[model samples]
Every structure is written in C-alpha cells, then in structure tokens.
Target: MPAPVPTPAPVPRQRDTSPAEGGPGTGSLYGQASLTLLVIEDDPAGGLTVPEILDVDGHRIRLRSARNLTEATRLLTPDVNCVLLDLALPHGATGSGSGSGSSDPVDPLAALRQVLRIAPRHAVLVLTSEEDAERAAEAVRVGAQDFLFRDELDGRLLSRAIRYAVERKRADIAQYKLAESKLRAQENARLERGLLPHPLLEGSDLRFAARYRPGRSRALLGGDFYDTVRTPDGTVHAMIGDVCGHGPDEAALGVELRIAWRALTLAGLCGDDLLATLQEVLEVERPNEEIFATLCTVDIAPDGRRAGLCLAGHPAPLISRPGRPARLLPYEDSGPALGLLPRARWPRRQVELGGSWSLMLYTDGLIEGRIGKGKERLGQDGMVEMINRHLDSGLSGEGLLEASVTEARRLNGGELTDDVAVVLLSRSEA
Candidate 1:
C-alpha cells in the first residue's frame, strides 16, 4: 500500500492580506490580480494532493493539472503565470523531448529541465520530498524559481512562494533588458569614437581644430567624414567629404571612405587618382546606385606658404589672413562629386598661402541651415560673411568653429537638420 498523502495545513477563515497586494517596490505583475498555476504531476492514483490556494486578495488561485510533460505543454498558455512541477514524477514513455529516450535512468532533473524549457517565461516551483533536499536545491540552481517540500505543503506557503517566484522572474527579465540596453549604448559610443578622425600632425607646426555634429537625434556620427594627416614628404593632407543621406548606413560608408582615404593618403595617393579610387570604393560600398559623395582636399607644402586644393562638387575652403577679410577659395572649376560620373577628373589647383593664415574646410550642412522662420538658407556667401563677423571679434581656431556652429543653430531657430563637419588648419610664422 502507498503511504497516505499529506494534506495541506488548514487556511485561516479570514482573508489573508499581505504585502504582496499593492506592495511597495513591486512591479505591475504584482497586486490583487489572480494568478493561474500549471501543475505537472503524474498522480493518476490520487496519491499526491494539492490544497486550494488563495492569493493575498482572498481569491482562489486558479490551478490546472497535467498528468505528464506532453499534457503540460498542451496546457502551457500565456495566461499561466506559474508552473509547479513534482520532481519525483516518472519520466514516462511520453517522448516530450526531455531526453527520456536516453539509457540513463539516474538523471533526476530531466523532468524539471523539460518543464523549464517549455515554460521559460513562467515562474517555476519544484516540489520534492524531504529526503531529496540535494535534488531540490539542484532544481532551483537549474533555473527553477523556487523549491517546495511535499510534506510541508500549505496553502499560505505555496501562495507566498508563487508570488515571490513570479516577482523574481519579472525582476530578472527587466534586469536583462536594462543590461542589454546599456551594453548597446556603450558599444555605440565606442564605435563612434573609433570612427572620428584623429589628425596626425606631430612634427608639423599647423594648429588643427575640428567640430562635427550629426543631424539625427541622439546620433554621434553622420554621413560627414574628414581626416588630416601629415605625410612622410612633409605635406599636410586634409580631406572632408559628405555622403548623400543621413542614416546609419551612410555613416558607416562615410567611415569606410574616411579610413580608405587615410590609408591611400598615407600610401602617397593624391589628387585625381585618389579621388577616382575613392569613387570606385563608394560605387561598391554604397547601399544604392543613386548615392554619391562630395569631397574637398588640400595638401599643404612643407614651407606652409603654398597649398594644393582639389574639390569634387564640394564647397571651396575659406581662407582668412591677418588683414584680409575671410573669403572662399576658387570653386568654379570643381569636378563632379565622387560616384556621380563614370570617369571624372578632379584637377588639383595650386594656391599661394601667406605666412600666417587659416584654411577652413567644411560640409554643406554648415551653410544650408535656414535663417530664422524663412525658407532662406545661409548659402556659401552668407557663411563667408558670418566668418568675417566672427573674425572681426578676434575669434580663431576652435572658438571660430564653435561660434560659427552656435550662430547657425540660432539662425535656424533650433538644431540644424543636417550633418555638419568643419576642419580648420592654421599656420603661424612665430
């Protein structure tokens, strides 16, 4: 004869209201709502008995019983918030993919693992005998939310455990999501920092300063890219370009183009050859055929008194001297932008730079901002005028770039709705 089944301890006559109902530090999953439990047990002979359970709100906790893993899976619905599994339940011939077909009969946690696999989102409580304390602890370690003793089964204890397990599961999921978000944010920050240019001007006397801002909200990088490097031939090479769109794919392509430009410039490629190869790269790496890039490059001589400028459908660089007003360099003979033509030629023009001067290369975003509420845009001419005003107040280098961007934003009435990149290279005789 089988041993007599232990009945649950008597519940109090009055409603038991605990902190689980409208408690502090509890999520939406908690409170007065009734919870449904799915119990997995092979109790055909009615030996194992579970008493009626009442939640903190005095409502009867709904219970659904399944004789085995197959039946449990069939009954495992989204409405079931918790699962109660009897660890001693026999792994019958019901092939529920719990590895019951294996020859090993000693694996006591196979049924528990199967229940966990099926009800991953549900809180699980493992029921075990007092003698199987080790296995009960192992069940909890194997992802069961909590463990219960068969002889100590009580309505109050079981209800409290169920609530605790559900809360814990919700907490675990929230923590996992928070950690995932934080990790993604950190990864994006590192990627943006890596993509930004780091000018190589160790030996050169040129003072380099740059400012970049992406139009997309909360974005660190955009379709605009730039780089400045002092080559082995004592020539300081500076290049700035803007991809067509302002999306992540465009930003990535800009990074690729920037890196390629750095590699090619360091390898002694310049002028039309460099721009042509860059066009080939854009044609291949761009997301679509309609995409293109506008670029401006300048190679300063060792003496810092002369420079070579090349424009590919990009704005001409603004030159500022001590006495002369700020003005744009020659852009009338500029070639088509990269990827716009099959075989375009970007002719490099030689420009004489005075002993003390500053050259500013920029993307179109700097001059495309709307002035006030009107549809009027701060075109290239307007940008030249703005620079002259800032220079009159003795602003130069980083200050000049900052003032220029801040005033443009003010003129637009808010943040500029385009990617802006400005690079300033200055040489002084002193």
Candidate 2:
C-alpha cells in the first residue's frame, strides 16, 4: 500500500524579493522582479512542466529543464538563480563517470551530489518521492537549501524555497569574510608587538621614555627602531637607528638590527667594534647592496657624568642641562652610514654630561620633516631651536617627546612621509 505524502509547512506569499530578476510589469530597481530556475531531471518527456508561479509583485518565475548533469552544465548561466535537482535520476551501474544507469543504493544521493558539484555557487533544492522523504532531508544536510516531496510539490512552494536558499547562501558568505578579516587583524597585532623592542634599562637611575610612529598606512611597525640597556659594568647603552625605506621589508630589517644590537652590546661590544659588528649584520640581512641604515649609539659612564658617542651618518643626540638652553651634540666627526663603505670606521668621542641633564636620541624622521609646504626642512639646527622652546615651557621626559613629535607632524602639514622614533634619557641630581 502507498503511504500518503506529508504536507509541507505553509509558505508565506510576500517572501523577501531581490533585484536579481524582473518582477510583473517592470522589476523594481532595488528589488528583483523575476527569478530563473534550472530543473535537472532524467525524463524530459515526463509531464513535469512547472505551473505559473507569480511573485507577490506580479513578477513571474522562469524555468529551464535538463535531462542530466552534462546537459545542465551547458545551460547553467550567470542569470540562473537556483537549481532544482531530481534525486531519482538514474546513475551508472558500475559507479562509472558516465552517470548512465540507476544510482548506487548505498549512496542514494549520488545524482544530487553530481548536480551540486557542477553548480556549487547556485542555491540547490532536491526533488524526491514522498516515500524517500528521509533521503530528501539528507540531501538538504549535504548542502542543498531545501527538499520537496514530488506528490506535494506546488508552484508557490518551489518559488519560496528558491528565494530563501539564495538569501541564506549570501548571508553565510558574508559571515565567513567578516570572521576572516578579524582573525587577520589579531595576527598582525601580535606579530608587531613581538617585533618592536622593549627597553632593557633595569636598575638604572636614568628616566627613559620613547615613542614610535610608522609612515605606512594601516601598519603598526616601521623602518625606525631604538633600544636602551644597562650593561654589567653599570654603563647604560642607548641607540636609535633608521633603515632607508618605508615598507614591511624595511621595518623587518629595522627589527633585526635592533635585536642584533642588543645581543652584541650585552655580550660586551661597544664603540667602533660594536658599530662594525652591526654593519656586518645589516649587510647579511639587508635585501640588497643599496640598502643602508643610519645609527646613533651612546654609552653613558657608570657615574652618569660622561658618555662615549658614535654616529654612523645618523643625527646627533641633543643635550639640555639646568640653567642652560638645549643644544645639539657635536656631530662633525660622524662616520658614513652602515652598508655604505667596505671598511667604515665609526670613531667614538667622549662628551661630558653635567649633573642633572637630559639627552635626546632620534632618527632622521625626527628632523627631516618640512617646516611648512615649502621645500625647506627642519634641519638639525631647527630641531635644536624647537627643543629649546619646549624646554623653556617647562616640558620634560615623556611630555617633552610627545610635544616635539606632535609639533613636527604639524609643521609638515600632515603625517611625516617617513618613520619616526624618539628616545629620551634624563638624569636628576635633585
């Protein structure tokens, strides 16, 4: 005895309509006025003609038929919105690629799966007999949008299923992309924090504060780097450097150089020997011979009253003491930048640091910004004047560095087109 087909849940008349097709008289600009369905069934001659199913807005749904997966592939066009695959279609007996005979009984959804593979982007609905209702539901679980029992299939029901499937697929794709974007953002942040150096000035009396800004858009790290550490002998070593470009590659090189500097310094290297070893590191790690880096390194004495200064074509450090205006350190005897000369000799000079003084070390990004829209740059002399003004206003330490960098960006009329890094070390006798 044949069992009666279970009636499907009622489908609403005014389903969400999109402008993917034309509706009744003329499709709305914002809403699809029509829909196109591709029906893949084994018997083309079988009386399976779709009845007239008009959308709520009077837009009519169009239908196309194919006897097998091969023919359906040829008719599948960009305009086809949904696919209706008949699950009863015959498959090859030997599990062959021809898909000629009845389907494999072990996997009754073989024919439906073939249709899905060919039209993966299109929404799909499986059509089966009422007796195979369980298999039809399984087809939906295998990625079909819905399933229809042959005995209860109606024009209105099919129309509603098509619209629902398409909308559901779009929502799924949007959700996937949003999640992917957030994951990428989190990974970049972790990578950046790991790459950027943290000050190693433990047990030192000098107050240290630093700031960095990348010139590249949407980037957290740049080609500017700095570090400070106190050696076993109580000599505080601080350095700031800049690579020659503005990109991730250059930023990566900057991090490498900063790390190498710390390793060598902690291992007891300083002055010309330290500078020479750093040049070797830059040469081996740089992407090309044309790549180079400017650096300024200072080793403060144990008493914090004197220091050894070495410059590799980098800007000089600024020093300001009580009862005197801020001034630029002597820079006339600096050596060529790293990776420039085969046997570059960076001469280290000794400078006296009076009691209660602040010293500023930075990269070219600090003083290279234009004074205004004009071509004139805020040269070393100009930077000296600017720092004197800030000192006159009673700003010191972090407040001083923040104000100076902000003023530089303002003078350039916008963000500087190069990476900026600033490090301030201040000693107080009071």
Candidate 3:
C-alpha cells in the first residue's frame, strides 16, 4: 500500500470550545476573569478530556487544541490565558519554522522549555505520565507553573491549577511595576532638591520667608523662581521671577537663571547692568525664541531703611506698614521682560522704606487666581484687599504668606492653576 499521507494539523481552533457560562463572582483568579486553556498534544484524539470545568462563577473554562508547538503558538492569542504542553509529543514533530530546531526527545522537559519561550508572558503547565514524574518536577523548575501526570489528571485538578497559575503570573507582574514606580519617584525627588533654591543670607538682620507652589500635578517645581542674598557690601539683594510656561523645560531654565543671578550678584553686579547680563543668559538658555521671563529685583540698603527697585515686565512689590493699608509699589517706568527687548533697560527706581515695613515681592501667580467661578480674576486690586484683611488679623511673616495663598486657593474654588512664588522681607523697628 502506498505510504499514508500525514493528516494536516487540525485547523487551529479559532472558536472557544466551551460555553460562556458564568454567574456573578465567577471570574476571580480562582476563576474571576474567564480562563481559556490551550492543549498541545501529539495524538489529535488523546484521551485527555475536561468535559466540564466551571470556574467559581458558573462560567465554563474555554479550550483550544493544537497537535504541536507550531499550532500552539499560532493559537496563543491574548484570550488564551494559560497553556498545557503534553510532554510525550516528539520534539521532531514541531511544524516547519517552529525555530529552536528540535529539542532532545530524551530530555523530557525540552517541550516545556519550547512552550515557555514562545509564550513568556502567558502561564504554562506540563503534562506527563506517572512514570515520568521526575521529569515533570524538573519542568516546573524550568518555568512551568505546575506539572500534571496523565494518570492523575482530572477535570477539577486541572481547572484549579490553571487558575492558580494565572493568578501567580499577575502577581509577579504587579510587583515589578510597583518597584519601577517607586524607583522613578525617588530619582525625581533627588533632582527636585538639587534644583530648589537655598537663601544665602548670613550676617544680615533682615528676616526672609518665601513660599513656592507649582501648578502642574505631581510636579515639585515650575517656572517660578526666587532667591535672596546679602552681598559683602551689606546690600541685601532679593529677586522674584516667572517664565512664561508651566513645564519642566521652563522650570529648568528658571533654575539656571536663578543660579546665574546668584553668582553675578555675589560678584558685585547690580542694577540695570546685572539685569542686562541675566537677559543674555536667558537668551542662550531658553528653549525657544518666544520664551521670556518677568522679573523684579530689590537691593535694600545696609541700614534697611531704603531700597532700589528694578522691574523687567514683572509685577510691583506690595509694601505694608504699621497703621497703613497694604499697597503695590509704583511701577511707572518698568522695562520689557527679558528676551523681549535685547537692549531692555530695567531702570533702578529709588523707594523709601522707613525703619519698620514689610515688602512682599511675588510672581503674577499671586494676583491671577480666579475670583469665584466667574470669568473675573482676583487681580492686583483684589489681592491687595485680601492682604489687608489678613494683615488686620495680625498675620505676618510665614503666617501671612500661608494665609494669603490659602485664601487665594479658596476664592478660586480650588487650587490656583499657575505657579506661585512669594517672598516676604521684613525689618523690625523695635
């Protein structure tokens, strides 16, 4: 008789062989998300049968059959939750292009290894004979979730093992992601600490308090920045500035500019000359031509009674004194923001700050908060009123700033949507 032609691999089972039967609570790993099992066997009519395996929920477990590893891989879709590999299948039986050539048939765990490689993300179980118990145990060590002996296999045992394997895999993946998230958070915290400013105010009687809040969610810093330092000449220099956008790139540029300002200020640069050099730094460090920064700088005399003010398109500082309502300092001859006018001249204007006074320097974020839900914003005027109320309540120093920002957030009905930075410099006449 002519040699019998080999039967083609059963058209890879495309449909779920079991009914989608399930009730509430049917799909936990114990059977919560419906499970589908793919069995790779050499004998198309192998006696292996799971006629009925219902998960906790009344849903039946789905099954797909493949004659060899090649067909098994072709049917390994996302829906196929677990795989069952029959150890008796001949290694040479793998269909063409199955890769890894043919595993050694003598090494009983060879087929198990092949399955693990093909479906690394999916769960795998090995099936063997009672006589090959030793090899089945080795298969589990080599990546199989569990092993089953042909003689001991039954509907209930296989069903529970499949659910257990799927749940275990999920737990492993979850643990990995959590660890990755924590590592990323730690790295970001270290970077933020490095970028944040530290006041350089040794040998100075002026008390300094500053508050910073970035508008971006989960961000430690934004485009707003400020710094205060007392130079050797006893001139206390304080600055507050804001870059146009609220993002990491803008925030980084702000940090660079703040550090450069500190270095130049400590080197005896001041007034319009210092600002001109800072503008140059901004031009070179900004991410694009459209980027710009609003700045306000104050140089208080050693006596703490008077100061020189310069504005680079920034808001004016608020001055509050005993027996007087808080008000914004004059902003009559302010210059354009840095990066806007190459030859910008931030004129240093003289301001009289008698013996006892509190000067509040801030970014526009302070006055731009919304007034309730209307389209109107809590502009400079509203901010002044809010401050007067807080000051009247005897709030000063850190208490004053905290209350101010909290009230701003409250009026807006939520958190302010812009980066806010406020610096308060106070001198006591007492």
Work out the TM-score per prediction.
Answer: 0.80, 0.76, 0.80
lDDT of model 1 at residue 182? 95
Using TM-score as the measure, the top candidate is 1
Record all residue pairs in model 3 with backbone atoms less than 3 Å apart, i.e. clashing: 21-59, 22-59, 26-57, 27-31, 27-32, 27-33, 28-31, 28-32
| Ranking, lDDT, top scorer first | 1, 3, 2
Q: How accurate is candidate 1 locally (lDDT)?
A: 0.84
Off by over 4 Å in 3: 1-12, 16-33, 38-49, 64-76, 83-150
Provide backbone clash counts, one per model.
0, 11, 8
lDDT string, candidate 2, 310-331, tens digits: 9999989999999998888898
Deviation (Å) of 421 in candidate 2:
1.9
Give me candidate 3's TM-score against the actual structure: 0.80
Q: What's the ranking of the predictions by TM-score, best on top?
A: 1, 3, 2
How well is each residue in 132-182 modelled by candidate 3, as lDDT tens digits?
888888888888888887666667898888878877766766787899989
Question: Predicted candidate 3: what Cα RMSD to the true structure?
Answer: 5.7
Residues 1-430, candidate 1, lDDT per residue (tens digit)? 1244655222212133332433222323454367777777666335335557877778777677777788877776656778888877765724464545211367778888777777777789988888889999998899998998877777899989888998888887788899999998999889778889889998999999999999999887999999999998899999999999999999989999999999999999999999999999999999999999999999999999999999999999999999999898977789999999999999999999989999999999999999989899999999999999999998999999999999999999999999999999999987
State in Å the error of residue 88, model 2.
Answer: 4.7
